[model samples]
Target: MNPGLYVFDFRFTEYFQMTIKPLLEEGKDGELIDWLKDISLLRRGQKCTNPDCQGTKPMEWKRARIVDKFHWSCPLCKKKVSIRTDSPLAEFHCSFKIILETIVAWCDGISLEEYTKENKNVKGVIAKRIYSTCTAATDWYMQTHPELTLLGGENSVVLVDTYPDGCMTTTPHNNNYTKRVLCVADTSHMPARIWAQLIDNKILDYQKLAAVVVGHIRPGSTVVASPSLYPLLHGVKGMAEVISVEALMALDPVDYQRSLKNLETIWRTTVSVCQDIQNTSNAEGEQMLRELEWRQVFPTPLSQILHDLAAHATAISS
Candidate 1:
C-alpha cells in the first residue's frame, strides 16, 4: 500500500474518533459529512484535456512517484500524471509528504521557523514556497468557488471592515504607518465571503474597495458597515440599501453570540478535517480529497468563529 494513501486512512480514523463519533452520539452524524462536506476545503480534479472524449471522469491516482508524491492518470486517455499537475503544487521539488505537512502547518497557523525546523528545510525556501502555494490557492479558491464570490440576492447583506497587519507596512507618509487593507465580508452565506486588499489607508480608496465588493455582490444587495465607511461607499452602484453596523449592534448579544459560535465551530471542524484529508495523497485518499474539496466552499468552524467575532463586535454597538 502507498504511504501517502495510508495517511488518509489514518486521517479517516482520526476524524471519526475526534468528530464523527461525537456527532453520532449527539444524533447529528446522519448528516455530518453532508454538512461538513458542504464547507470542507479540498481540490477539484479536472477532466482529461482530450476534448474529443465524451466522458467527463476526473483524473485518478495511480501510484507514488519516486519523490513520494502520489501520481495520477486518466484511464480514458492513458495519460499518467501527478497531484501537482494542475495545482499550485505542480512543478514542486518537495515530496508529497513535505507538501502535505506544509499545508497542515499553514492551516494550523504554524510559524515559518517551526515549519522549517520540522521539515529540516531552509526557512526562506519554506516560507517562499508556502506563500506562493497559499496565494495561488487563495486565488483559485476565490475564482472556482462561486459561493465565495456571490453576494447578491434577497435577504443578503454585505459586511465590511478592516484588520491591522504589521507585515503590510512599507514606506509611510502622513501617518508613518500604512493601513494596507480594506475588506468586504459578505454575510450572504453562512460562513460569509471575504475579499481583502493591500492598499493605502485613505478613506477615498474605499471607492476601489466598493468596486471589488460591488463586483462580487449583486446590485440591490443590502450593505452594512461602520459609520466611518459610509462616506467612502457613497454613490456605489448595485446596493439596494446600506445599514450602519450600529443597527446590527442593536440585536440581542447573547443570541448573536450563540449563533455565531455555532457557525464558527462547524467551520473550524470542516477546515481541520479538509486539511487533514489533503495531507494524505494516495489512491484511497483521493476520494476523500475530492469530497473535501466539494465541501470547502461552505462555512467551516474557523470561519464561524471569525464571523462570530465580527457579528458580536457589530452587535455590541447596536
Candidate 2:
C-alpha cells in the first residue's frame, strides 16, 4: 500500500505502457488477471473501514465463488468488502476477467447490446454493469482531475463549434438537439482535445458561447470558431478567427474542408451510435460520450485505461 503517495505518480502511464501492455499483447490475460488482482488488492494498505474498528490489521483475502476476486475480511471489524472496494472496478460486482474483457470490448466501440449478444449474457446484466461501473468511474475521474474539469484551460488553440446531438430524430428544417464543444489543440500534443455538452437549443448564440468560453478557456489563447460563433469569439480571452461555411466558400475549399475534418468524422460516428438505442435517454448519450473521451485520451488497454483514469484520479478507501 503506497499510502504515502498522495499526488498521482507520473510514471503510472509509463508503467502501463511498459508492464501491462506487454503482458496483454502476448495474449497472457491469465497472468494479467493475477497482476490486476494483486494491484487492486494491494493498491494501498487500506485500513479497516468499519467505524468502530478502523484498525491496521492484515486482512485475509478469501477466494470466493467469483472467478477472479478476493473477499478481504478485516480482522478488527470482522467484516468483508471486495478488494475492488477502492477501485473503479468496484461498481462491477463481477469478476476481474469479465471487467477487463468488457473494458476492451467497449473501448472498441461495441454497444452494450452487441457485447451482451457476443458474450451470450442477458442484456440487462451487461447494461447495468457497464452503466454503473463506467458512469461511476467517469464521475470520479472528472471530480479528481479538476485541471481537466473544464476543457481549454491550458494554452491551446480552441476551435469552438456545435453539431446536432442526434440523441433524437431531426427533421430537415428543425434540429432536435445540439451539442456545443470546445475542440482544443496544441500542435505539440499528438491528439487534439474536445469537451462537449448537450444544449437544448440548436443555436449557440453569442450570449451562450460567451457564458461558456469564460469558464472553459484559459486567458490569451487563440480561438478559431465556426461562422455562427465567430462573432462571439471576441467575448472570450483569445485571439479569435472565423471559419464559417460562407467564409470558407470564398477561401480554398481544400483548407476549409480540412479544418474540422477529424472532429466531424468522430461526431458523425457518435451521432449514429447514439441514435441506435431504442428510446435513447440522456444517460446513454453521456455514456457514449464518456467512452469516446476515454478512448481518445488513453491508448492503453481498456483495463489499464479504466484504472488509471479512476484510481489515481482520486484517493479512495473502503
Instruction: Write the residue-wise lDDT of candidate 1 on 227-262 in tens digits.
Output: 566665656665888766545556637545443343
TM-score leader = 2
Candidate with best lDDT = 2
What range of 10 consecutive residues in model 2 has the weakest lDDT sum?
Answer: 1-10
lDDT of 1 at 60: 74
Candidate 2, clashing residue pairs? 1-44, 1-45
TM-scores for candidates 1 onward, in order: 0.45, 0.63
lDDT of 2 by residue, 191-307 (tens): 444455555445746586567655665655555555666676654444434334335445546645443454454344334433332245666655545544443455343554556
Model 1 Cα shift for residue 291 (angstroms): 20
Compared with the true structure, model 1 gives a TM-score of: 0.45
